[model samples]
Target: MKTMVQIVDYAERGQSLYIQLAVTDGETEKRISGEVRFLGELLYGELVHDKKSPLSEQARMDTIAYLKAHFGR
Candidate 1:
């Protein structure tokens, strides 16, 4: 990674996991919405979807399986 301006802060308490994340080259900030579950135990991943997502449940499962096959699990 090249030199870039950065900003980071955090807070933890209560019964929920609330996090804010972002990455940038100082001019543009590309941020994605994320939800953390069972904090302190694991950090799971998710694919974004609107109220309507074309991919079926099985399609999603197969795609994840393929990723695990090529990448480390």
Candidate 2:
């Protein structure tokens, strides 16, 4: 099943960058809203059991692009 990820919002706390996402499996969609944490090149994310989506992958890639374009990381 394919997944879609949408960034809802984000926040920064100390050394951690957090993001909230609305994810769906293209069918039987659930709010299943969750957050992810980014630290340097490492990223940690929460996923609902059996609700697998490409949240971590997209978040990492997108965040990297964001940093490179905006912050020149």
Candidate 3:
């Protein structure tokens, strides 16, 4: 399946950055909300998926790659 990811919202709250994403794979569309927490020079993202829509692993990986490229990280 061809996956597509769109960033719906991005915001910085304190030491963490929050991102809202829309992920689609032609057949299904899901919402993924993530928080990127900064720890010194390192950062990690925790993603929450929409149970109703359900997300594929490929779609999730694509979303993460999109976010990395979007931030130029």
Candidate 4:
């Protein structure tokens, strides 16, 4: 599925960032807002778990890929 990702907010947190993202795949949409901490060249974080974000594991990974493409180390 083709997905779209947009950065809604970017908050600085020392060496990391707390980001708010809007992720969509035409029909379904989700809000992925969380803090991302990088270790060396790797980024680790989780998507916000709530009723509004009924996304599958694959969807969440895709969203992360998009986020990384835009704002990764």
Q: Mind giving the per-residue lDDT tens digits that candidate 1 earns over 11-71?
A: 4565433333222222223333333222443333452132232334443344334333422
List the candidate 1 regions with Cα displacement exceeding 4 Å. 1-54
**For model 2, where is the 10-residue window of minimal lDDT?**
64-73
Query: Which portions of model 3 miss their true places by more than 4 Å?
Result: 26-53
List the candidate numbers ranked by TM-score, top first.
4, 3, 2, 1
RMSD of each: 10.3, 5.9, 4.6, 4.3
Instruction: Report backbone clashes per prediction.
Output: 0, 0, 0, 0
Worst 10 residues of 4 by lDDT: 45-54
TM-score of each: 0.29, 0.50, 0.56, 0.57
Query: Pick by lDDT: which candidate is best?
Result: 4
lDDT of 3: 0.57
The C-alpha local distance difference test score for the whole of candidate 4 amounts to 0.59
Runs in model 4 with CA error above 4 Å?
26-53
lDDT of 2 by residue, 1-73 (tens): 4455567887777777777766654344344577766665555654522245434454435443543344222
